[model samples]
Target: MRSCIWMGSEEKRMAPGQSGPKIRLAGFTKFEKKKSKPYSYSRTAKLLERFKNRMSERKDAFGPQVERLTVLHATVKKIADVERAKKHAVEQTEEVELVE
Candidate 1:
């Protein structure tokens, strides 16, 4: 039996009368071309800009109604809070009078 040791500076050789490993020559391989879609940044930007403009226009049309509803909601909440505070104050006064 022989040791299959290899050295960096030496070329590849085979043992007595044995065939060596086959070498592959460099060659270009044939490849299929794939069809792909091209992307455009300017078209995407224009679409986004158009969408924003439409959204702003729609918001403007309903802006006054939206403001009125918001104000109405705030007024109702304020009234509820005032009523709650008055009830809490009365409860505290009754507790103090009973203690005295």
Candidate 2:
């Protein structure tokens, strides 16, 4: 059987005079126009600058913590290795060698 895959349609089906649905209450009388809020360029710029500074400081803060964790993990691994070696040593000491 033949098969076809559809991605995005290039044609527009909506006409120029067509309108969408609107919701309204039965007893509503007051209808106020929504006003667009004014954009603050200075405040946005300041916040973006502060955000960049905080992001830069995060690396320095986490750098020490990451190093500390690495050192702790390495120390723990070394202790485990020493413990394993000690166990092998004790087992070997308690073993009886077969005489030929």
Candidate 3:
């Protein structure tokens, strides 16, 4: 039985036609520092102004309807509270009569 030892191949020699300009290998540390534009206060102010205008327009369109609904809700809640108190009073009177 013959035992064989494995050996790694030598570095590849470039072909004669491929020897002109060396190929550049891209690496993580080779990036250029990028220049960022400065923030503008005027642009931010304009955006905020437009947002506020749209919000005010929406509030103006729905303000009266919202107020009317709120008032109706409060009136309905008051009526329900009054009916519940009356029901409790009637139950108390019935219980007292039964006790007597």
Candidate 4:
């Protein structure tokens, strides 16, 4: 009742009641680094910083647009309030043209 673990890829047994010769671990390929310059910390940092700077520049470009949008939103709200009041009024509205 002697048993041995199937240690070889082609001859190894994966479960009980399996019998086979021990597998050899030879000829396994070793990982070699590619023939190129290794990664640099400074280069990575510069790339990340450039990305952040570009994003900040875009945000700055939109700064004035944001203020305009805020003012436009307030103006639209006021127009809506006026329209609501006009709708609630029983008096007829006259279209008056002001000569500037």
Query: Per-residue CA lDDT of candidate 2, range 19-44, in tens?
Result: 53333568766686789785444444
Global lDDT scores for all candidate models:
0.60, 0.56, 0.59, 0.54
Best by lDDT: 1
lDDT of 4 at 20: 52
* Model 4: per-residue Cα lDDT over 1-100, one tens digit each: 4445644565433566666565456774665667988544445444544554555577777676555555555565566667667765634333232322
Q: How does candidate 3 score on lDDT?
A: 0.59
For each candidate, give its TM-score against the true structure.
Answer: 0.37, 0.34, 0.39, 0.29
The reply for model 1, stretches above 4 Å from the true place, is 1-62
RMSD of 4: 23.4
Off by over 4 Å in 2: 1-61, 97-100
Residue 2 of model 3 has an lDDT of 28
Evaluated against the true structure, the overall lDDT of model 1 is 0.60
**Candidate 4 regions off by >4 Å?**
1-61, 91-100
lDDT of 3 by residue, 1-100 (tens): 2222234664445455554434455775466888978534444444545555555577877676556555554565566667668889999999999999
Q: Which residue pairs show backbone clashes in model 2?
A: none
Clashing pairs in 4: 8-23
Candidates sorted by lDDT, best first: 1, 3, 2, 4
